[model samples]
Target: MAEMRLIKKGAEAELYLTDWMGLKAVLKRRIKKGYRNPDLDSYVRGSRTSNEAKLLSEARRLGVPTPVVYSVDKRNCEIVMSYIDAPPLKRFVDGMDPEGLALTFSRVGEMVGRLHRGGIVHGDLTTSNIIPYSGLLYLIDFGLGEHSSDIESRGVDIHLMRRALESSHHEVSSEAYLSFIEGYRGVMGDLSDPVLRRVDAIRRRGRYVDVNHRKEA
Candidate 1:
């Protein structure tokens, strides 16, 4: 095992880029929390690492282009996966032209739709979690993922992406957002009415209007 350089640090896990078994790989290690009791903390970490691996396997089985899992150490509360050598979608779209932006959004939507259709919901669907390489879009980070056949879960996934775009990429927010939906709907034909309603609610809430004024007396 070579020195693991920190690639990403998050609330639940820290990602490191290192050589595993003589191949380049990503190592996601659960961080220890001092606030919680030792026993409970260990259990939570173990469970999370296991769940992430299971979800990734499920997504990959359904043909989602995620990193392939190489190994897992439940005791260490860590997982090793293939490293994707591509810029995150956030960086990729930062300099994209109109056509490139549209293509990127469409592809993101399609991938999400496929995952939802296969009964998976990526709890976090931000551009930062996606990579654009070789004209292919790959979704990463299953830490918050769950299996859900519910349309609302799927809608929330898309809604999160829209919100992320609004806050992060303000310039092309309108057009890029529309392209994302086009691809999502193209796959999840006639999405449940409830899902659309929830998406509308997400939009309304995103306006950041006074919550008290919005509620009917």
Candidate 2:
């Protein structure tokens, strides 16, 4: 086993930086759960690890720039993939020129549309999942990804991206998000319209909750 240093530990998996075949790689290992039966836990973790590997591979085959999956060990619930050496889009957004940000945002939108067209839903579309390297965008972390042809699922994908922008970079995020929409509309067109509508509905729901809380306070 190659020595791997832990990078980040989440509820489900621990991300490690490791060396593989002379290239830098990421090792995602599902943490063992004692709360569930061992057999059930193993089944769930193995299934998720396998599913993500297939989804990522398909994304690459379809021309989406996701990390190249190196290997999957179902027994261990581990997946190894190429480690992106670039900062995530969220980090770069702070230092991006207006023009660069606009271009990046457009590229992100186009990438998302392409994924949708290919019948894949990223499930999680946060800026952190987008890595900007060598002036290109690479989508990462397909932990929640799935194959779906439903327009609502695709709309939810866009809505999640919008929510991520609002939460991470409010003012500039809005313009950048609009640029994403512009790019998405260029390709996905009316297919994304339902998702845009859902974005509005989600925002209203949030505002309603906020207003009620304020009134009570």
Candidate 3:
């Protein structure tokens, strides 16, 4: 219970900037849902808290840069981890020249590729969850991630990244995504082909759904 300052609050959790064992840390506490049964809520939160911690450690073990996990308090549904003192990639990617942007995203793609190759999928693959620090891209917030090597799961990761870029970095989305693909291919090689194909198929399905919704409208 070190002196804490609220940093970010989301629907499911709240992030607090605090010190842990005299080191800078971020404490993520899953919030309770008033509507859910108290026991169920506690169980759900505790399960997710444990799972996220495991995913973070696994990702780091696979050589992806991630914040070091300091502690986990399942009863309270809290995890205290190293605080990454850098901007999220969503903000960091802004104002970079085309070359820099390409290089940066290429690296992003490689990191993700490494994760996928290691049988993991970042369920939430948005730039907002990424940090570029000390010449490395640090992946953070594994709350939504899991160990999955299925084609659909892997495709969803790439699709989510593309959608995130298009929504947040529209002006440079296409170029950035292409560069990402290049780097991803470099690591995944033949394995990347099927996933890329799956991405295309997923995109088409999305477009079809959008068209149907438009028709209904």
Candidate 4:
């Protein structure tokens, strides 16, 4: 076993930077939740750990850039995977010129299109979960992702992305989103139409809810 140094400690898991068979790796161990029954907690952690590993591998098979999964330990509720040595896209895209921002987000859109075309929906699609490495945008943290090809699922993915950009990259959100739509259409072509329409529907639904809340207030 290699010496592991703790890197990130999130609410659900802990990340350790370590080495595996001469390869730099990250070990993600799901923490046991005290609020749940011991048996339930164990089962949940094991299943999620296994599922995330499977999703990571599946995304790679779909030709999307992601960290190569090295190993999975269901017993320990942990996954050992290749570590991407790049800042998250959230920080990487900050202060980028318009042309560069458009290019970067278009690639991101293409990657998401590939995933959706392959029947995968990233439930938590955010720039923080993406890393730009080796001239490719690598998506990470599939713990919330699942296999789904429905229009609603794909629309939610794009909707979440748009909201993320609006909240985190507002300065360039409009242009970035347009570029994303362009690349998404380039990949999905006719299939992209329905999903894009659904995104607009979802946005309108959000606005409706917000309007109701404000009216009540």
Candidate 5:
């Protein structure tokens, strides 16, 4: 095992920064849960780890900006992958001018459109999962991602971001998302309007709506 520096520990996994084969890498090791049945625990960890790797590869194949997957080790329930040196978008998006913000969010929307065009839904599309690397934004953390072409699934994914932005980046969230929609439309063509309509319908069915809209209503 390479010398690892602990980066973060979440409920399901522990992230470590390490050097792999002379290249910098991130090792996401799924933590075993003691409360669950031993066999079930192993199965869950193995499947999620494998699925995450698959999702990353699929996204890359679909031309989405995602990390390079190095290898998967089911025995250790770990994934060793390229280290993205850039900061997450939550930290990166701060204090930018409105024009720069709109451009960046538009690019973000295009990335989402690319993913959806391939019938994939990034189960978690939070700012934390988006990183900027060498002037391009890359999506990371596919642990919650899934392959789905359903409009509801796609709508919900977009809706989740609307919720996240409303809760976290309230200051510029509204305008940022509008920029995203514009980019989405540019990339998705005819599909954009329907998906966005579903986004609105999905929001209406939920307990919350966009914060700005709620205020105006």
Candidate 6:
């Protein structure tokens, strides 16, 4: 095995770019936590790695662009997957003009809708998790994704994306989000209502709303 170069380190995992079995791949290795019980920590890491790998393949099958898993080592709490060469959306979204930015966000929303329709909820939905590839948007980083048919989970997914946009690209956030909802509705059809209503309910709960969201323009 060629030495895997560390690309990022996160709370749960470390990302490495490597050549696995002569194939270029991104390896996600769950970080070991010393504070937790050994047995519990291993179980948590292994399960999350397995879950993320499963969700990555499943989401791709549902026509949601995501990396292809090459192999997994449960003992090591690592997953080797195809690497995407595109930059995350957060790096580019702001450079686009209003119309262009909204158009891109609409595609992001549609992808999320497609995932939801397939019974998956991306627990972490943010600009940083999206990539532009082959003239389309690809969703990445399924560390927080799971299989869920619940409306609340689905609402929370979209909610997170909207909040991400608001904070990351404040200028085009609202307009882009409206476009996102349009694309989501287009794919969700009749099912969009319940989830959207749940999103409003979540906002009303007050936990997701910060002073910035409450302030008038």
What's the TM-score of each model vs. the native?
A: 0.86, 0.85, 0.90, 0.90, 0.89, 0.90
In the order shown, the candidates' Cα RMSDs to the true structure are 3.1, 3.4, 3.1, 2.8, 2.9, 3.1
- Cα lDDT tens digits for candidate 1, 109-180: 778888988999998888889887776778888877888978678778877888799899989988998898
In model 1, how large is the Cα lDDT of residue 132? 73
**In candidate 4, how many Å is residue 101 off?**
0.3
Q: Which of candidates 1 and 5 reaches a greater TM-score? A: 5
| Sort by TM-score, top down from the best | 3, 6, 4, 5, 1, 2
Q: What residue pairs clash in candidate 2, if any at all?
A: none
* lDDT string, candidate 6, 1-217, tens digits: 6888999887778989999788888988998999999999998888888888899999999999888899989889989998888778898987898788878877887898899999999999988888888887888888778899899999999889878888888988889899999999989998999999888788778565543467667
Backbone clashes (count) for model 6: 0
Model 2 residue runs over 4 Å out of place are 33-44, 202-217
Query: Candidate 4, which ten residues in sequence have the lowest lDDT sum?
Result: 208-217
TM-score of 4: 0.90
Poorest lDDT segment (10 consecutive residues) of candidate 1: 206-215
Model 1 bad stretches (over 4 Å): 35-40, 203-217
Record all residue pairs in model 4 with backbone atoms less than 3 Å apart, i.e. clashing.
none
Quote the positional error of residue 164 for candidate 5 in Å. 1.2
- The lDDT per prediction is 0.83, 0.85, 0.91, 0.90, 0.88, 0.88
lDDT of 4: 0.90
Between which residue pairs do clashes occur in model 6?
none
- The predicted structure with the larger TM-score, 2 or 4, is 4
By lDDT, the better pick of 4 and 5 is 4
Instruction: Tell me how candidate 3 scores on lDDT.
Output: 0.91
- Which candidate achieves the best lDDT against the true structure? 3
